[model samples]
Target chain A: MTTHDLEYDNPNAIEAHNMSVYYGSFRAVKDVSLAIEKNRITALIGPSGCGKSTVLRSFNRMNDLVPSARVEGQVLFHGENIYAPGVDPVNVRRRIGMVFQKPNPFPKSIYENVIYGPRINGWKLSRREMDELVERSLRGAALWDEVKDKLNQNGLSLSGGQQQRLCIARALAVEPEVILMDEPCSALDPISTLKIEELMFELRQHYTIIIVTHNMQQASRASDYTAFFLMDSDRTGQLVEYGSTSQIFQNPKDERTEQYISGQFG
Target chain B: MAVTELRRQPSLLRAAFERFIQVLLVFAAAISILTTAGIVFSLVFETIAFFSEVSIVEFLTETEWTPLFSIKKYGIWPLVTATVLTSAIAMMVAVPLGLIAAIFLSEFASDNIRRTVKPLLEILAGIPTVVYGYFALTTITPFLKNFIPTLSIFNSLSAGLVMGVMLIPFVASLSEDALSAVPNSLREAAYGLGSTRFEVAVRVITPAAISGIVASIVLAFSRAIGETMIVAIAAGQNPRLTFDPTVPVMTMTSYIVQVSLGDTPYGSLSYYTLYAVGFTLFIFTFILNIFSYWMVRKFREVYD
Candidate 1:
């Protein structure tokens, strides 16, 4: 696909335009627009119930799994609106993979877990090619050294941190251009959290990563760009500020953003 | 001195009431255990008397089962084989039908459809077994005869098929429960990886819920083995060693029912044979229950 929009020199990985998400009649996320750049780590930071995760889910159309959830406006990926008629959510999810807050690995062997994405997409790879793919994916997630000896063990047998990385590897196997993470390190310990932050730095060279985090230090430490969200008077979440991480953290743009970042109130 | 003064003594009336309730609860629990023990005692006693009259070797080895006739061959294989054959046929009908229905209910059916249809499906189980017997004899047998012209009027095929219909609720409801008990995280994980609903259900949910599914099947098999009225009314009382579903056969439960019709004299070898057959049926069901328990314990996956 040719780049039609000139908003960024690097070409935006994903852009949301007047996107609003509703659960039945209750609006969860108000119209909020943001452009995520290619090959950068963008952290969405806010208190609980800010709809940051909601926007993250909308990026890959993960919210479609919920029976009551509905989307309006547009979530543009490679200049194509994902929510357009005849655009299948299944194909959208394949092109933009996700990792959840909690580590979720299939109840299968580690080898099988890595290959599951490719297998479901109907890849016809031989045994040797399959092994190579597993190794490459695991190494990309920086989990190969610890889990390579036990590829046949169940993925659930791994530690919580390892499982999250395994999920990342599983996402990487399908070769997606963008990866969405919803509080991926919230359940992890500080050490595991640090490892994930370091891995994000390593992965930023190849894949565009958008993360929703509740941890302030993590957003400041790990992300190149930061978007701050807060609940409106009606409790519908709206984006308050979006800028470079240094600017959003240190400089004042909005009084609410300053109050939220400096710990005056959530 | 301060501690002793601050302490309050327990009330005797409330303590006595609590003791009474505990005793009542223990008695209620013991009643069920005592009843099972009582049944085992009688079956064993009568079975011992039966073995005294007929040698264990003859009971195990001989092919025919005619304790009432003058020639009187006291073999058990005919009844055993008949029971196994009918149960196998019933499984053939029930397993696929029940599992497919379970998959649809758990994975495909909308909530409204599931809520409305599950009770209707369970109503099949609520139908009395005697009614199923009559339906097999009056309806299914005549229906099958049109296709298999040589089909017997009193055949195991009709009885087994009707019994399988009676058993669908047991398998479907339990299997559905197992499938639904799988965590939503697993489903989300699969869908996020780009799996279709079919792939998510078959490859992930089914395998994850396999232990419970196997347990359900085993329990349903045990229930089918112990079912009597359908086999007695439709499958006939001809005890013969055969696997042929088109022929007349008798299960162990049906044999027990046959003797309990009150024609045989009390304390006769033929009368004692009822308890022996009941004991055999009890053993089969008991083994199945233990196997199901072991299967669940061995393969159950705990999701967090």
Candidate 2:
């Protein structure tokens, strides 16, 4: 892949054009168009049900799980249309990893949970290689030092913070290009949330990340770019502003964004 | 201040009513326990009285079981063996079918399909066992006779087969509950990792709920062992130790029914045989119930 082929001028990892999501007859996200940069943390901050999480799920087609949900227009990843016919949703999901709001570890040992993604994808690594990968992934999530001696223990035996880190490691084990985190620190204490924010800074060097959060300070602290979404008069979510975090918080282009950051309204 | 002074006195009648309700609730719970204890105590005492006259060795070792004949040979093995054989066959049939149905309902069925199928399954459980006995005698026996020419009109094979069908809903309903109780997040986590739906169900959900599944199987086994009307009506009351389902074999339950219906002389060996058989059946089912309860209690749910 040459520099020209990769196109660093517009190094957009994800490009959404006129994408709208509907559940039954009610539209949740209306004509949202945004370009997420590669190798940067983009924070999606909005009030609850503002379609931030909905847009995050749309990236990996996770919304397909909802029986009544439907998506229109285009979502492109690496210049390829993810929702095109003949494109496998499973393959799309494998390339784009996700960590839910709550930590969800399988009812298995820590070792098993970390290796689950690679093992399912038929990555035939030797036992030693598998162990090294597990350790590497755990270290990448900033959890290896805490759980090095208890790899054989059940994943559920860990504290809430440790479990969330384990889930991050699980997502990392697959070697995905992009990671989507839906309020990954919402359930954690302030100290653990700080730790996760630091981990996210470290992770941005290798993988493009999109995080949905309600905490404005977290978005300002950890993200390079921020997208502000707001509910319209009709109760549907619409993007208000998208720019560098410094610009969005310090000098917002939209008045709605200013009011939102100034705590006048959601 | 004046209104508060007037309301300061608590109503004695209201307090007494609350106390009365609490006492009644406690009394109801105690009655449940007392009823179980009474039945167990009566069964034990009567069983002891029966065992005094008949040697334990004779009851256990003898193969021929003819309590009413002029030359009585009282051996419980033939009846016990019959019960085991039929239950084993019934379990072999029920476990696989029930588990598959449960997996389908819990994992694969659409919401609409499940709504229709689950109640239809429970209807099978709701059917009276006597109706199953009649169905076995009339339909299943004749059906089996077409394949196996040697099948007796009243044989353990047909009875056990129909009994297995009757037990299907019991196993399926409980196993479905176990499978449904497995958190949706677990399945989503597996899917997010690129696991196929089958892989998630087989690898994650099944193992997560293994204890509950095992408990359901054990409970179904107990139901099969304790079933009476199906075997009594379809399986002839002749206690003979034979593996061939073509021949008439008597179960412990069937023998109890036979002896009770015949009006055997009071205080005679035949009269005492009922208690002996009842005791053995009780012990067998009690052990199974305990094992099932233990397996369910031992299960640990994973939540993060």
Highest DockQ scorer: 1
Alpha carbon deviation, residue B168, candidate 2 (Å):
1.6
Task: Report the C-alpha lDDT of model 1 over A132-185, residue by residue, as the tens digit.
Answer: 999999999999999999999999899999999999999999998899999999
Off by over 4 Å in 1: A1-10, B1-6
Chain B TM-score against the true chain B, each candidate: 0.97, 0.94
Residue B100, model 1: Cα distance from true site in angstroms: 1.5
Q: TM-score per candidate, in order? A: 0.96, 0.94
Worst 10 residues of 1 chain A by lDDT: A1-10
Best by lDDT: 1
For residues B1-304, what per-residue lDDT tens digits would candidate 2 score against the true structure? 9999998877899999999999999999999999999988888888889789878899888888887898888788888988988888888889999999999899888899999999999999999999999999999999999999999999989988888998889889999999999988888788777777787888888888888899989998988889999999998888999887878899999998998888788888788888889989999999998888887777767453
Model 2 lDDT tens row, A123-226 = 99999999999999999999999999999999988988899999999999999989999999999999999999999999999999999999999999999999
- Which digits, one per residue and each the tens of the lDDT, describe model 1 over residues B90-207? 8888888999999999999999999988999899889999999999999999999999999899999999999888888889999999999999888888888888899999989999
The Cα error of candidate 1 at residue B223, in Å, is 0.5
Instruction: Please report, as a residue range, the 10-residue window in candidate 2 chain A with the lowest summed lDDT.
Output: A1-10
